[model samples]
Target chain A: MAKRTGQVRAITLKQVAEAAGVHASTVSRALNPATRSMVVPEVVDRVLAAANALGYRPNLLAAGLRTGRSHLIGALVPDIANTVFSPILSGASDRLASDGYSIVVADVGTNPARHLELANQLVARRIDGFILATVSRDDPVVDFCLDQHLPAVLVNRAEERRRISAVVSDDALGMQLAVDHLVELGHARIGHLAGPETISTGFLRRKGFYDALEVHGLPAGDYPCEAAAAYNREEGAKAARRLLDAAPGITAIVAANDLLALGAYDVAAERGLSVPGDLSIVGHNDMPLVDMVAPPLTTVRISHREIGRAAADLLLQQLTGGESSTRNVVLAPALIVRGSTAPPRAQSRLRNQQRGAG
Target chain B: MAKRTGQVRAITLKQVAEAAGVHASTVSRALNPATRSMVVPEVVDRVLAAANALGYRPNLLAAGLRTGRSHLIGALVPDIANTVFSPILSGASDRLASDGYSIVVADVGTNPARHLELANQLVARRIDGFILATVSRDDPVVDFCLDQHLPAVLVNRAEERRRISAVVSDDALGMQLAVDHLVELGHARIGHLAGPETISTGFLRRKGFYDALEVHGLPAGDYPCEAAAAYNREEGAKAARRLLDAAPGITAIVAANDLLALGAYDVAAERGLSVPGDLSIVGHNDMPLVDMVAPPLTTVRISHREIGRAAADLLLQQLTGGESSTRNVVLAPALIVRGSTAPPRAQSRLRNQQRGAG
Candidate 1:
């Protein structure tokens, strides 16, 4: 039953023992750092030499059974193809690597059941903890982790209840910055391209949009807002089209994500309208290459890498017998004004008309 | 020695047995799918219900020790933040998931020693096989895998020896496409921004550039060429600056990557040279957002996702006891024509002069 599959078998302790003319137990003692001191120095040298010659790699899985620490962390992302998640994964993986932890990333998509199944599989491998970047407002996986007493931390998204630790950017403040920039640019009739309501970013950013409108003494109900089915370009394009058709006078739009903002760019092109000339747009999560886009995007730059590192830190705290309190680390968001946003067309026209009269 | 880490203890088999009023061995037999028939039907039902109520998860590590099938695959990438690798990972992971195999991806930068260390760590965890995207033209990790008789497959980049199966884009064909497009636009003086020669893409593409020049009856050595230290924007900028400085008559430039092309765009902007009007550019690897650059990039499009799927398929073959022969899968690349390419300034000026005379 202990036989390995496939044709390749790794060099065993017995083989090292035969080559060194020592007992198999002596080879094992020589290999283990803690037990190496008990073996005679001459025998230990011979066993190590034999093991090195044969390319005998120690089985960490077997060692983990005795130590009860696999030192492997499981990370789950909603979409691996999304540029936004990659930096976050890189940050978390880099931080964990320094601490001698290896991350096994699973692109679990948006299915909750699949998320739980993948989580269970990772748990079966005896992972130390989880750093999940795939969580909705009210997630079943969160509940599963809590029920099983597993150590897990959320990144980029948080659960409705504060049952576990999480590290996320301030969603409401991100929307506020976008809206404030648009209002200052004299955009009165502003529309919104919202994300899915099931996720925290979508739900909170939508609420924040209306909240910002109210703060500016504008009627929130007068503006048109459409929610995309998902955080993707196609869904964003669909929602953008619906918003554009529904609100013809809108001169600006604030999207919940960079992909949705790019979707708005697609819609603007389809309608033969120039960005910032006919419509000003702003995006969230200033992902890579947004600065190089035609009319570089005016976006809310959230430090995704920092968020990932913070999440890893929280998980590490729990894994290392540190603090166990449910702490939510909310990072700040900054507005990066680029070419995609400008003063409204009517205001610019009036200024030009005034200049002509002068 | 088997006590778990941290403060949380999992629901044990003995706990399930106590809840079901049965012996621990009986509970284990009832829980295992292979041995469930050995237990009475009523007792099996009781044990399952008890296990479900207690949230008892079977220890897969322990089971794997007995069966020798972990069903886990290890994958290595150079950089996760680079958008090119994301689609490949997404494709490979999606394919492997269907076969009940989960992939653990490590971003092993470009250091051969680090790559070897990470591979050895994954091997220690008893990964069934490896899918390597970090191999160079003559990679040490490739040699290590071969010496250990490990089942490993290469993706995106292949080793010079072809000791293992690999899936890569036809890099030479990609260069030919870029050069042909520029030549068709009447660009007689073309410069090249070559990638590092340590990589297969860099070496093959540079060779292909000269091959295409000869095919088109153009002198290869007459043109300027500079190789970047790495496939990054900063290095590309340094290389592009050198090429532009060395060749004043060059009207068109072909870059090995989109980032290098964008770096050329930066240099053009710095020198107040307009794209296509002063200098025409062609790039390779039509990564995300390339089409949205100020003057959308004209580049070679590699089906990275297909390359990833093919690589996974090859690894699956080796893992499942299929073909042991080494095979190379070369995917064809296509040219995506956009706004960055045009006729040379001299030819356009000559045409304008002729029109003026008419």
Candidate 2:
């Protein structure tokens, strides 16, 4: 058998399409879930039948022998356990699965070096495309994925240099919705428990809150903003305390994430203040349990599942010989008004302090 | 290449091992991650180097062609995004990864019949083993997976008839702990919101709670138990209300799962009852957000991750032919004391109810 030495007689997807009497790209699309719907069912069946008859099963290594194309797509995720990334993995996997291609994912962990090793393994596996959910400013992985001429898509993040295909919700819109919901409750002065500036979601959402105030024609002061070290609640609590201390006149706090909102809720109670009555609050991400909270926090809802599906769609496009142009898929966000926010108190300490009595 | 027909030269793992100057089993162990560490580093290095140099990449498919053993395992899960399954998937995958095996998982929806098609695909793929997490009391998949002579393992659920290779937490011990904690809190008339009896966790945990109370010499009349339709929050709320009506004097409530616990919280709020003060509540499955809730949940902390890892360990044993007989793994549960349960109200509500009746 010549050791089956990872070599095969060269055959092209184009020939399969031609044999099936379909466009070459149509065969490509038919093999992919994202574009499969665009092809007629009969045509898809014919193309798949022809491919099977030809024994054209995706042989990643043997393809490495044929056209030197591995056809393996790679997905990188920060945390697979998080609800947000579940759909992304499912979406990308499903899309790639249809096209006789498979996805290999690398976990982004507390250990950055581990991620590098995982990336190298995927590269060694000869991944021809990549989807990165943990893109940071000036990421080396991004450079490596791109330098190899591997089609790459980013989820929830964009490189500082721009021009990367990304599927991210408008953090600015998310923050604006939260701010507007609080302001509609008659909060005169609002503060923001912002996430870290290091992350795109944090940086954009914080700026979005300030921009929202200006858009709503309100005078904004620098005291209303406090950035946390990270998106987690411990950082949220620290940032919330600083926000309240710096802006004692603030009637409501809009947390960049639900965990941060929870932190603010705790700090509010520890200081002998009652939520909604003493101070109103809104959180972002609409994460689970926020609705079950004591006052049922008001927040913005982003489609986590949609984000996943879209990211996968973008990756499949690149895999199927589609344009290499960078596409930005910005999903919309909406406000969910619950019982958390209320009007400023009649004996408003914040209002009195803002009148120059502080 | 003789058309690379179905019949091809067979290279037994035995030959590969002998060629590498090692025992056949050691070669098998060297290729498997679980047993890789057991092989000395020098021997492993030699084996791997020799195998690569000889182009001795054992064809997983070719092995199935000869022995009808695909060396593939199939895992079925209810919800991939659920926090509980994350650890389980990772644990199982990590265990299988070492053995040069991959576990293919499919999401089982409301109608389990959908699993039939997915299972057929796995069979066509010639999967040698099955690891299932969503087994009901009378699962047809059980007879199917077993009849195929395919080694199968169940997690979180067990078959009613036999000792299958299953991994589950000691739910009875978990119930005892909940009951003991509530008793320590001085609750006399307690209510239990149980999960669906259609699943093993539901049926056993409910029985355990009753058995635990009996062991404590508490009369069955002192407790009112209502089984939820499902473990989800809505069913939990329904079960909680049933418990409240069945035992109006109930001072404490023990729920089967965290979602049911959250539902009980909603019912308590609706009745204008204060948690821990008027209606102490205890829950199982320390799922995410329980800690973030207004009053953190007091529940049994079962290691979802550990369960996953344990299941993986069990499957690897089967895959590597280490354990020929079927076995079940039972994990211990820890009780996490949180803010949800407190001493029965000083005013004594159950005593007051007795007095009013008198």
lDDT (Cα atoms) of all candidates against the true structure = 0.85, 0.74
Encode model 1's per-residue lDDT on B21-98: one tens digit a residue.
999999999987889999999999999999999989877676666676667788888887777888888889888888
Q: What is the docking quality class of candidate 2?
A: incorrect
Clashing pairs in 2: A31-A98, A31-A99, A88-A308, B32-B98, B32-B99, B33-B98, B33-B99, B88-B308
Proportion of the native interface contacts kept in model 2: 0.15
Q: Once superposed on the true structure, which residue ranges of model 2 sit more than 4 Å away at CA?
A: A1-74, A90-105, A123-130, A159-163, A217-224, A320-324, A346-358, B1-74, B91-105, B122-130, B149-152, B159-163, B221-223, B345-358
Model-by-model DockQ, in order = 0.53, 0.14
Taking the tens digit of each residue's C-alpha lDDT, what string does model 1 give over A214-245? Answer: 88998866678999998888899999999988
Docking class of 1: medium
